[model samples]
Target: MQNNISHKQSNQAPLYLTNFISFPYQSSQQDIPVTQFMALSPFSVKWSSNGTGYKLYANSNPNPIYTGTGTSFDIPQGFKHNTTLMLEASNAAGKLYAFLTIIISKPTLTPDSITVAGTMDNPSILTVQGTLYAKSTLTINGTLNLGNNNSFNDITVGATSNIRGKATLAQLTANAIAGGASITTDANCALTLQPNATVNKLDTTSVTASGSSNIADLTVNGNITANKASITMMGSWNLIKQGSAFGEMTITAGTDGLVLVYIDPDNCDAGTNATAVITYNGQQYSVNGVNLYQVQSNNALKQGYCCVPVQKGTSWQCSGSTSGNGQSPTIYVYWIPFGADKSS
Candidate 1:
């Protein structure tokens, strides 16, 4: 008896085989981590193939390091560096080839530049040999030790924040405070508070206020000295109680027989003239002229009080005079001192 024999043969080569990689595939772009990639003694690998047999070659090896009739294979690991691998497969139809680079160690780097696009939580300390710049706000919740000088355009400190370290700056600028704030410095510390600033206890070298300054109370522990310190006042005093017009009104001499007006020597402005005028009845009278009789009893000294005696209901009044019949008229006063250094 004769039997008919038949055999099947492949006429087309393998096509579209991809993702030829080992398990836990380590990408070329990322550092090959230690426990997952480098520690495997024999890293397992698998590939897609429509071929009969395959052979894997390592770094310039003339002989195949691994051979398999199936699609999966193993790479005898124990590699200490980046390794190059080549995969060759062949079948009755044709042959196919692929290449791979395995990473067995992390790359060494000086890391001159690194941009952290996402949050980086590193438990270890990072040393930056070059400058580290942040396009936005760089918040540091941990301690940062700066190896070199750094410059910042603006910095805001919270009300609870405090600067306690010693620093010597060539130039330092601080903004004004709108609300109440306090600044305290040591005895040797030198602090300067510029315009529009407020503090509770200021032991500073200098405090200048070109703008408005409101201090509830200021207590200076050191010596208080003034240079060209001055207080100026300009206005007139209204002496009369009732009047039919708006000119100088004078008060009739009272029965006290005492000088009705006296200027405190310390509060007087010496060099300038403080001319007196009397608005009496309905007309204006100058003290240097008609109202001079009020001080005639004391010879009308340029300073001090003058007495004038007259009966009530008389129209003898001094217009814009500080003294009245029995009342002291309201007047504005200012103090300004001029000279060398004066201490208090």
Candidate 2:
């Protein structure tokens, strides 16, 4: 009897185990918060008592926390945001005990959600797919799982988020990628990875400026910046500026002034124009219009991008107000082929 009781003691309250996450995400889509995590997925839980083995609440209702024989447990979904993570531990003599309540939460996700914190002794992994708009700070251990085509929309990480193994897109931007990560939505597709003044990761992708178009305010890292007077972008509509501080726009032309078209990576073109949305970037003299001879198209736009220059009259409204961006921008004088895709 004592031996059986001893065995139970070894399997107490919050079990300590490895962890994993599964969310409904993809490489070229938007990211939605996941909601369920099966108990089988391993989790490291500190025991309530100084020793091992205990009871865990599997359901939110009936609230029947179970007493297990081992230190391992299978937690359920819905119960994730409990916040009050409590556990019960026991000893060989059938002594039940409680321990410190730990906080278990991660960035909000879709199908599966779990918080993985990287500690000095126990650093964990954070797998982000598609376009990630981190409203908070994230930490990673050896590596952060960044799939190709994955974009981080305005999220900051620990000093430097790296993968001792093979990290994916530690530094990310853009949307409409080929594939790899499991993201589903294109929210904040114009994602930006804060330039860690100290740690600047290389961007594997390239943004080319051609035709009579040029780019301005698009900073540099180690990434390639293709420039020319002609923009070889994809469609009749092109170039989605930094929606917020969306970098800057340079209009290239053979002559002096012309109209410019700005696409919305967040929304598709609305019939003749794209829908307009406003972010936090300033908008006084920062109007989305053609600056009289911003730059010349035939010239190289390492600092600008342009299209087939047109007469000043072709000035069409893509989706902004002659006043404020009351709407989205259209590829007025240029073809709509340019946009920021999340490339790894």
Candidate 3:
């Protein structure tokens, strides 16, 4: 009798484990960052293994998060911490392992637009990169930083809210703004105030108003010094007489108490004893005592000038004798209305 020999086949460990078929085992570990504002949807990690069974462990724990023969493991939602996941695939021989790192990071929000129905309270600093729009009101207890080249529209700050730091805005409409050291505009830019806008107090070193400025009421408590002053008269340089004898020239006054008279006598002898009288409001005023007369020996002419008081809308005239003999005199009169004094 002959003895028979027995034969046995040995099992082999899993090989070539990979999530991607094209690139098998390209990397042993994978890092994934989870943000605060990120979606909490279920995710899966798929792999192709030659093993008959698979188990996924989290953070080196003894208990497995998932155990199945499927090629993919579904990660549950609401995982909000840093976790290290290990996928172990096994057969009759040995086991193969794959690692993944879930890194929990700080919240980063990059939204195109945001609408808050109620209130958003942040104790720390709040920085904004893009355009922010508040339909109702925006209240910030801490600092608010609006980065460069960013603009916002229609922001209403409450009384309790405090806004600090540099802010560049396209347009701002507020009922009142208080407690700022200074507010400045860019070059070639203008800060426009509304028609009904009222500045209770403005304490600045200097103020320049360009173009046409229509101020309803401006009161200056301090002294006003200017280079030049221009006064516009209602009627200027009216010729009462060109070459005429001494006679009364009637004039209708345009403004009260603002009148100027000019007299040019042909010869100095004509103005030696010259005397002019203004009859206004049933009263006679003399201009002979006025020391505004100039006598030129070269031209033998005398020029007299005076500013007299006259009632508005009243009939007035200047009548006087300029010469003892026959001579002609040139006379002119003008008046300035109220609120015609302007300075440039």
Q: RMSD of candidate 1 to the true fold?
A: 19.3
Q: Give the candidate order by descending lDDT.
A: 3, 1, 2
Model 3, residue 117: C-alpha shift (Å): 5.1
CA-lDDT, candidates in order: 0.45, 0.33, 0.51
Count of clashing residue pairs in every prediction: 12, 70, 0
lDDT of 2 by residue, 134-198 (tens): 43444432334454443443333433333223333333432222222221223222223222211
Quick one: best lDDT, which candidate?
A: 3
Model 2 earns a TM-score of 0.17
After the best TM-score superposition of candidate 1, give how far the Cα of residue 237 lies from its true spot, in angstroms.
17
Models 1 onward score TM values of: 0.24, 0.17, 0.29
The 10-residue segment of model 1 with minimum total lDDT is 335-344
Q: Put down candidate 3 lDDT per residue, 256-300, tens digits, no spaces.
A: 545666666654334344566767778776653122234563435
Q: TM-score winner among the candidates?
A: 3
Ranking by TM-score: 3, 1, 2
Model 1 residue 242 lDDT?
29
Report the C-alpha lDDT of model 1 over 194-285, residue by residue, as the tens digit.
Answer: 56665554445555555455453455666656566643222223233322113444344322121132232233222222324333346543
